[model samples]
Target: MTGPRGRVFRTVSELGIHYRRSPACGVGSRSPRKGPRAGDRLPDLPRGLQARSSGPGWHLLVSGPPELWPDERIALVLRGRDDLVGVHRLGGESPWPDVVQGLVRSDGCLGFVARGADLEGLRAYLERWLPAQHG
Candidate 1:
């Protein structure tokens, strides 16, 4: 895909997950300290989702069965889940995340974010929100 500036962006999608390149870990807060700071290694990334170094920040990627629709907008659902986000803790910090960016692909890339919902629910949710790729 091409960016607004006409810069060609590489698309990463496999299984049932989609990937989008983000500047940093934080989606809303401008303050870097509140989220995954630059150069910080993501702790306990979800099994289905992944983040890799994208130039200065990271490229959040979702992987799953190829049948999964490649919906770039699906990443937006990651907001407001502070429990799953990784931050630089001083001491006595819980390593587990309640919600983080990424999702468990149908192929089993389990992510750190625990939606508390089952896989069937997730599939239904996706079907309701995004259009089918094969249909």
Candidate 2:
């Protein structure tokens, strides 16, 4: 399977391209493939995140506060872990700059978040507030 047919992302600027991985269509990984093996890109969503999507509009139901994930970053997250992802919230001091009182806007937007006491609380916030749009 190694050939020019495969997609390859080389630089930061080219991250937007569809080269690294492909999409998966399911609730979770079917058979749980082997280590570092080629298989469906999107992994199974941890029970935590799967609960959030029950309501509406792109709710990031992970184990942390993905409170403000921009559209593009979401794309990045979706491209791979279209199922369940373990997201972490960056606080008072991280690489991203604060865009809102409690949210930070990173160069990418796979997941955006708010400040919370712990990872669990942050996950709750993301499930509570994710944007919805026309895919």
In the range 5-69, model 1's lDDT, one tens digit per residue, is 33322223332232223322122222112323222333333332233221222133323332332
TM, every model = 0.21, 0.19
In order, the Cα lDDT scores of the candidates are: 0.29, 0.29
Worst 10 residues of 2 by lDDT: 35-44
Instruction: Score residue 21 of candidate 2 by CA lDDT.
Output: 36
- For model 2, state the Cα shift of residue 105 in Å: 11
Stretches of model 1 off by over 4 angstroms after superposition: 1-117
